[model samples]
Target: MIPTNRQITPETPLDSLTLDELDQLLSEKLVTLQVDLLKTYEQQLREHEETLDHLHRHRRAISLPPRPTIGQDDWHSYVYDTRPSREIASVTDLVTINFTNVHTVVDIFPVALDNIHAIYKLDSGNGYILQDDTMHLLTVRNQWTKSPTGCSCPGQASDTRCACCALGSVLCQVSASGVSNTCVEDSQINSHTCSSQSPRSLELDNAIAFEYHTYSEGVQQVVVIAKGENIHFYRLDKWGLQDFHSLKGHNTINLDSPVTHLGYGEMFVEQFGTVTRKRYLFTFGLDSSSKRYYEIVTNPQDFSIETGLSMMWDTTGTSMKVWQNGGRVIIGVQDGTNLNIHELTSDRWGRQQISLQQVLSLPAGVTSWRSYATGFENFLIATTLPLPALYLTVATIDRFLQTQRNIPRNKLQLVGVTAMFIASKYEEMYCPEIGDFAYITDKAYSKAEIRKMEVTMLNELGFNVSYPLPFHFLRRNSKAGSVDASQHTLAKYLMELCLPEYSMCHYKSSIIAASALCLSLKLLDGNNWSDTLTYYSRYTEEQLLPVMCKMASVVVKSSSAKQQAVRQKYKASKLMKISEIPQLKSKLINTLAEKSASYA
Candidate 1:
């Protein structure tokens, strides 16, 4: 919170300020605060989007090389083909994890998937409080996973008292020790008891745990029980479960309270116009609805919730979490087969309005999933707990390898990881420790090796990483083509298809991108390459035809090619499943390739 020139001069007398002057001063400060808020908000938003885009492209070496296809069925007939140079890893994805009968896997706040403490469902309402692979008799929650249990809690809760542990009629009160543990913990299961108020039957759709900092009561743990439109708030202190008045606003200096967090209320008393202010905090979250129902609670005091000003919004969402106290909202919305995730910030001006800041898309189901928030901050610690950390890794490796005429095979793995380390520093939002990067190699390289290599690589490359990438040019050319979502994605797939081919490296990136898009438009039965594309791309149809031929040739061999990473990636529904489109196989492409090749 930097002091601004707008601050009323401390040297000025208080009597000189009038009510109108005070109001004017307050408005200006607020406007300035909001502008600063918006700038910071936009910056974080851009980093998040770039991180996703960075991950979306190549995902670095995070994904295991396509299942190793060289062994097993083809081992007997497989003959090693000698080439000038080849990959350190097999391109074909051979390793796969197979499961049967399970419809949905629910794990809570997992550190990792394979080794997580969770309660999973094996369809038909049969629940397993412990993960099948983890194999533990104990569970964090006391839900009878075996036969028909007394509770048919459909949803899993974050920590100890999950909705799954709740019998359609009772709220489970967990001990404060389980407070920090969201999904499961290795600790003993806490005793569960229903609220003493009788009939004790209330079905729960979702249960969330959050921390609240009160004006008087330092830091308190809070739990929210959301079922349909009805919400219940409970406080979890050392004294155990106590009812909180409806859900008053939580105090946070983070993204939650935008203005005051920046001290907008502290107008100068002497030099600045004097302003007395009463605090009015607001909170908004999904109230409940298949059609996306939400509610905004306005003017709640620090201690108690005010009932009169709750406003509901007509929208759809599956789940939501308030982060930075109440500054921003993270929501999960179901869009067809995919679950769309979004981040929102409250509108600085409006009492009930919130702005959408970020978006994410995930596949229908995953064996293991990790929920992220607070920890996604722009800290220096690498969580590989996984960005430009994608292309930066590529640029580093390409530069290092291209410069070194001869490098040892054993050191190649070290070089690869070292490049990733350098890239993460340059491009990644949150970079892990140098030791953490070393661990990713299964101890093949020591921390000292990675740290030493990092220095060597940076010095050898002269710290230059501004290598132009195909994705960059592809974006401009796609805009020039004025293509639709499918056409643009198909173009991306075509461009990526040529990435593995050694020969394609000879052409300029801009030409390669232009050619891929040009072929995509023609293949889709869309318009021909126009003057705009030629002008922006600086590649005429005849010149592009040659590169376009190479791209088409890569596509023809893509399905059968050893490098299946590009094909497997674009085949997902998220990327519009462009690789599976039929135009890649058409004779028209063969004709174009032959025609282009004939020129040389």
Candidate 2:
């Protein structure tokens, strides 16, 4: 045992003490210090063990639920419906409706197969749901009532809520009642003076864009609007544009420059081996020296601005899109018609990092490619106008060239023309006369020979000319998402630009549309998508990212002589001079190439 109190000193006089005595004193003191340190270490170990055990018990008591299995099925089911069934053969002659009196159309909602086919049009401050035989005019009103019964109000009853009136005389009567029953009687009196407020009227003149998305409940639809610097979401029912929430606070976006584009989409990330989902709103606009991008989390349950990832690009952005499971972002900027593709990946520490992958020039004149193909295909499918005929026509020609090794390269164009002619005769309401086809070909083949080739083509195709085309899917998606007309046009142009590239033929129509729309939105500085868009397009941002980047690369290389037809046509003002946009600098292209190589 060590002494509790001891002094290891020359207290008895050092010179008088022997060597053995001094050594004994030093040994005793050293042993005492070692024992003290060991006791302290043991006490610390016990405390730490207790702390660890407490933490374990607490964690066990409040254990988290099992994480959900996230797979392709989950992704598909969570995504919007890309294809909705509709009759193709029941239609009569198409008719166009024009709203002559309306100044600007804010929104249009078509309710299909109602007792009577109807369309709802919201213009200025008024809302009109017009049917074949009836028209309902919607108005906004706010009023206070004295009874629980219904009042003479045009708005829906569910939209109104009860409120207490603070007018005189009620307070004295309530106090006269006993305090015990005062609470109950006060509630009764308060219920009687209920006031209902209606949704405020929308200012159509100020509305820049409007889109509809299904609420979390899934049944109710909410209309989101981008007006000035603010975004507003409204609940839509029989009454139009009911105020839900303004989407402000910490996530509020106040731009120094005017907002040019707005987009919304959901992002999924893996956190601690579990999938976490977040819905984000993306905005792009010009700042003092360059363009800036902002991303805000808009899941009403937890809203925040992702300022850490938001950044300003070196140039002014006209459009931007996110895809590839949020691994890639593509932006179309105005600095010499440049398209910048960025790869978002995790760094060594698993933190998100974005690097510029590719910068490419926007090729001119994709419109001509589309126009020629469209005209030829439309003539073939004139009768049924089935979109599949167009795909089949392309497929037949592709298969022929692939299998027939002996076929001459010079005959490819002729084979394509023949396929289109054969497809039209089978699908069109009235196949263009063979003479008309010959005329279109500048009388390249004699009438009899052209007729003979059509027969040969049908025999080779086994008389089946039905396949899906991307145009219909692209158009449907653009309409459903309310893509701006200009952006839609640009998307269509991008789709046409892909036609001459043999590699693009492997992709389906939906995939093509998804990529084209992604690129188009970037070019026009528009929102890439909303949750509703994801559902409708049946595509997630991440899934479309790689395709978008590929398309951007193709657009860059397509500006040469091989694609002159497309590039020349878009140079016209009528096509919005899409093809003549500025090209990206060579230095930027090289830098992007190096980055892309590194990313790969």
Local error of candidate 1 at 257, Å? 55
Model 2 spans > 4 angstroms off: 1-395, 403-405, 426-430, 439-444, 582-600
The estimated TM-scores of all candidates read 0.38, 0.33
Which residues of candidate 1, in runs, are more than 4 Å off? 1-389, 593-600
Candidate with the greatest lDDT versus the true structure: 1
Residue 209, candidate 1: Cα error in Å is 25
State candidate 1's TM-score: 0.38
Which tens-of-lDDT digit does each residue in 478-508 have in candidate 1?
Answer: 7766789988888877866775467776677
Question: Candidate 2, residues 1-600: lDDT per residue as tens digits?
Answer: 324454445456766556776687767677676656645754665565456556745975795654333211111111001111111112224455665544433334322222323223343434455544445553322211122122222233452222222222122122222111111123434533322232244532112222223344433433334444554444445434344323333423455555544443443444333334443444554443224444343333322123335555454343443332221233222232333445443332324444675543333200000000111011001121133445556767776666566766766557766776776666555454554444334334545667676777667757666655777788788888888776776776777777767867777778888878876775566365568778998998777766666566666776664545556546645567776654322343234334433323
Candidate lDDT (C-alpha), each: 0.47, 0.46
Provide the lowest-lDDT 10-residue window in model 2. Answer: 365-374
